[model samples]
Target: MAKISAFEDLEVWKEAVRIGVEIYRLADLSPLKHDYKSRDQIIGAAISISNNIAEGFEYNNNKVFIKYLHYAKGSAGEVRSQLAILVAAGRVNNEDYEKLKSDLSGLSSKIKSFINYLKAFNQKKK
Candidate 1:
């Protein structure tokens, strides 16, 4: 298989961006009008996931990149938690909530695994 050139080329990052788009769409349907707080928070967290990944990849330093990966994972968790709140408050249906939750979980795991892989790779080079 050919080598991947950047994190933008990574399937995980692509999936994370898709998840972000879905979150934005969901936020638009939320009944909490005049509450820009939660909506912006959720959208920001979702965007952070892919943004961090792209920023990390551009850094080219394993340690810095891993830090950004961790940030992305945290942002995923934030988005997941916010979605859970929306579900509990009856703002989002079970179907949408579950689907987004699962996607976020997968993105979190992928980011963590990528971080571990990079750490190991760098260690081997030292």
Candidate 2:
């Protein structure tokens, strides 16, 4: 594998950024556009996913990176929950909801897998 010298080189961080962009686009649509609180919250959570990953990577320590990874994972979950709420309120359609959920789920899994990899790497170094 190529050495990842920046957070942007990480697949997980890329996915998080994609999700954030998609969420922002969705929020710009009709119903979601009017829902200020939910829109802000969902946007914040989506952004947090990428931000946490970047922040953690910048720390340059396995333990600190893992701690930020956990935060990123949690933010992914928060985005899913907020998306569900939007779906329930008719702010988002079923198809969009399903796609978003699937995307977030995949992102969450990627984060978890990376975390596990980091843990194993740390253990091996000990």
Candidate 3:
């Protein structure tokens, strides 16, 4: 297995980057773009997802890392909620909202799995 030396090398973090970019592009193309408040809030939540992961990993402690992972997962939920709001407002189409929602949910599941794995690893080290 390849060793991870930085947050950028993390698969979850990488996936978040891809999703963030996609959300930004779609948001820009949608009517939501004109609503700076919603657009910025959604984008900020997207960024927070991966950012929490990176920040937690830097602390180099499994317990602290797990806490940050929860934060990241929470952010994913926030983004999904924002997406739903946009869809309801007709600022974003159902198709785009569904796709992004799936992506965020998948990411949240991965974060949960990662947290579980980390907890197991920590137990082993104890």
Candidate 4:
């Protein structure tokens, strides 16, 4: 495995970035464009997922990184929740919403796995 020296090199972070871009694209479509509140909130949550991962990795501490990973994971969940709201509000189509929701859910799972790995490694070092 390649050494992960930066957050951008992380698969989880990359997935988060993709999820964020997709959220923006979805927000640009139809009624979401007019719903400024939901648009901003969803977009912010999506971006936060990747941002937290990157910020935490830069901290150079596994514990701190894990904390940030949790934040990112929470943001992913938040985006998924927002997607459901947007779909129910008729702001997003079923197909688009399902795709984004799946992606966010997958990202959250990846983050959780990474956190588990870090926690295990930290425990081993103790």
For each of the candidates, the C-alpha root-mean-square deviation to the true structure, in angstroms, is 1.6, 0.7, 1.1, 0.9
Question: Candidate 2 lDDT, tens digit per residue, 50-70?
Answer: 999999999999899999999
Task: Compose the digit string of candidate 1's lDDT tens values, residues 15-123.
Answer: 9899989977888785743458888888888999999989988887889989999999999999989889978987778899999998888888888888889889889
Scored by CA lDDT, what does every candidate get? 0.86, 0.95, 0.91, 0.90
- Model 3, 2-86: lDDT tens per residue? 6578999988999888889988897787488899999999999999998999999999887998999999999999999999998
**Which lDDT value does model 4 have at 118?**
91
lDDT for 45 in candidate 1 is 89
**Mind giving the per-residue lDDT tens digits that candidate 4 earns over 76-116?**
88888888988998999999988888888778888898999
Give me the displacement of residue 17 in model 1, in angstroms. Answer: 0.4
Please identify which of the two predictions, 2 or 3, would achieve the higher lDDT against the true structure: 2
lDDT leader: 2
Q: Which regions of candidate 1 deviate over 4 angstroms?
A: 32-34
- Decide which is better by lDDT, 3 or 4: 3
Clash count for each candidate, listed in order shown:
0, 0, 0, 0
Off by over 4 Å in 3: none
